[model samples]
Target chain A: MIVAERKPLDEIEAMLASAERVLVVGCGTCVAVCMAGGEKEVELLASELRMRAQASGQRRRIDQVTLTRQCDREYLDALAAYVEEYDVLLSTACGAGVQLLAERFDGKLILPALNTRFIGTAEGPGVWSQRCLACGQCLLHLTGGVCPVTRCPKNLLNGPCGGTNHGKCEVNPENDCAWTLIYRRLEKLGRLDLLDAIQPPKDYRPMTKPARLVHPAFQTESAPPTK
Target chain B: MKDSIACLGTETEGTGSGAFEPKVVAFCCTYCAYTAADLAGAMRLEYPPNVRVVQVLCSGKVEAEWLLRAFEEGADAVYVAGCALGDCHFLEGNRQALRTVAYAKRLLAEVGLEPERLEFFHIPASAGTLFAQRAREMTDRARRLGPSPLRSKQAVESRKLVLPPDPHPPLPPAQLGRRIRESEEL
Candidate 1:
């Protein structure tokens, strides 16, 4: 899922200075799981903004709304009726959600309340660590389940470079050597011989180009239907 | 002689005063503090009646604004009771609650309220008696502190005048009509 972190309160406040009526919209999907933006968080932010406005002697009306998924047009349509009630929208969704709101709202102002972080998962409770770079390729089969592109400081495809010592990366001793992990996993699987096979330098063109995936099940027929 | 006159005035004031009955909001974790409060009631152990308990799935669910809202809604004191550190039912829920409480304290202080009015206590589900004791202790401390200054007359008088609610009916249908017309032009 896409990970995000909330922007500072002061920065968010600054964006809505002219907005007398503000709508704080939260996404209940990716940002929610990451604890950046969710229904609960949306309410909390709205209350905070209300308090701040009250303290500043500004009588602002701040309303909060949460959608099942902010990136989807169907869910965003739920906000159609209430969108005009506010001068601005503070969206606590991923980057996609923020843009979706802008596109749907058209001329209405939409501001992001979160810094979109990365495609990652929770490593432990409250600890989210990046696991994929979305390099438009799948090399997990060659490197065990770990992706050196994200885990390794240098995206080494075949490595346990001399920089790896005692299963720790010399770049930062605190970090586990991704290549060491790959080596150990392969050794345990008794596929150590696979490492001996030489791999060509990765094709950067694929990583640089915009990638798209089409599910065969969802594919549309190429030919136009008869009238 | 001047001090004695003031003391006499204070003594006369004291005679008319009643016992401090604090209004407290207890945000209790369902697994521990809420259950402990129930246990205390079952055992017929009487604590202050001032506390109003709000049961949350986890203490981590308690956001900084919830505590602030408690104060805004006239709570003189707020307490968050959760499972012991490192023993949260949801792993790090209690730890997250702890961080939130700490941040809330700083925010309360910034907003001119005594941070002590907000308290956090960690106890296991088995430690029912400990929970009761802590609640009682917190209630006593709040009673001594009296009501929060945020709700005091002095604070209210000092507050700036807020503008009245928007008298102008929302931007008329004509404005929305214009917006729609402009969109079509694009």
Candidate 2:
């Protein structure tokens, strides 16, 4: 899941300074799961903003609503009727959800409340650790499931750097060396021989910006007549 | 009202009950602290009634959100009490809870809530007296801090802030930015 944290309260307040009526929208999917920009978070932030506004004597109106998923148009349609009810729309979703809101709504100031961090897995109930970078590459099968691109301080693809000490990274002694974890997993699986195959540096050509994918069925779908 | 904000204005600054009674939420593990609370009651060991005991399977199950929500719901303080160290019914439950407690303290501090408002206490099931004593200590600590500043903001005086939804749509970003800049110039 993509992890996110709400922007600082003061920054969010600055974004709202020009608006008298504000609507805080929450995304119920990834940001909600991560406890970042979800329903509970929207309430908390809205309350804080209200408190701050009251203290500053700022005549502001803050209303809050949460959508099932801000990234999807179908889910966002739930907001169509109420979208016009406020002067500013503040989204407590990840960057993608905020952009989707921007695209779906026009003539409104749609602001992002979360800073999207990275693809992570919940390590514990509330603990999340980065697990993937979405580098448009898949190398987990050979690397024992850990993504060195994200886990390693050096992003060491080949092997552990000389700075690796006693299975811990020298950069931060608290962090377990990613290569060390990979080596141990492969060794336990009896696939140590796979490590002998040297991999060339990752290909950069496919690391294209604004990447898009079209389903095979979509290609042959009937199209409207062209002029 | 959906925010469940408990107090408002002057009446809130002084809790309606006359005396300031701090509300505290205590998360107790089923095998240890929860049982200890029951034993304390059965033994007639009096503790402050303010501590509302929530029984959990393990203190380890107490997530950071639970603690934060307690504060948001107007809890003056919260504590997790579990089995004694090295004596968790589930191995290392109390130890794991301690780690979360530390993380929660920093999170509370960041949110302008008092970090001391959250704590972790460890005691064996047999130590009923210790449980009551800790409850008294937490209640006293919270009483001194007074009601949370957040409570007063919910008063009707904040009507202008939580105004009904406005019909006027916002100006475009370009125009809004110009408005702020012009206001600043004034």
TM-score of each: 0.69, 0.66
Worst 10 residues of 2 chain A by lDDT: A49-58
The 10-residue segment with the lowest total lDDT in model 1 chain B: B152-161
Candidate 2: where is the Cα deviation over 4 Å? Answer: A51-59, A220-227, B1-108, B111-113, B117-143, B151-186
Shift in Å, residue B51, candidate 2: 9.1
lDDT of 2 by residue, B47-160 (tens): 998887887999998877677656655678889998888999889989899998997787666556678889999967988899999999999989888765544343212221
Cα lDDT, model 2, residue B117: 85
Candidate 1: list runs displaced more than 4 Å: A209-227, B1-23, B28-65, B82-116, B122-186
lDDT of 2 at B103: 75
Which pairs of residues collide in candidate 2? none
Model 1 Cα lDDT, one tens digit per residue, A106-131: 98999999999999989876788788
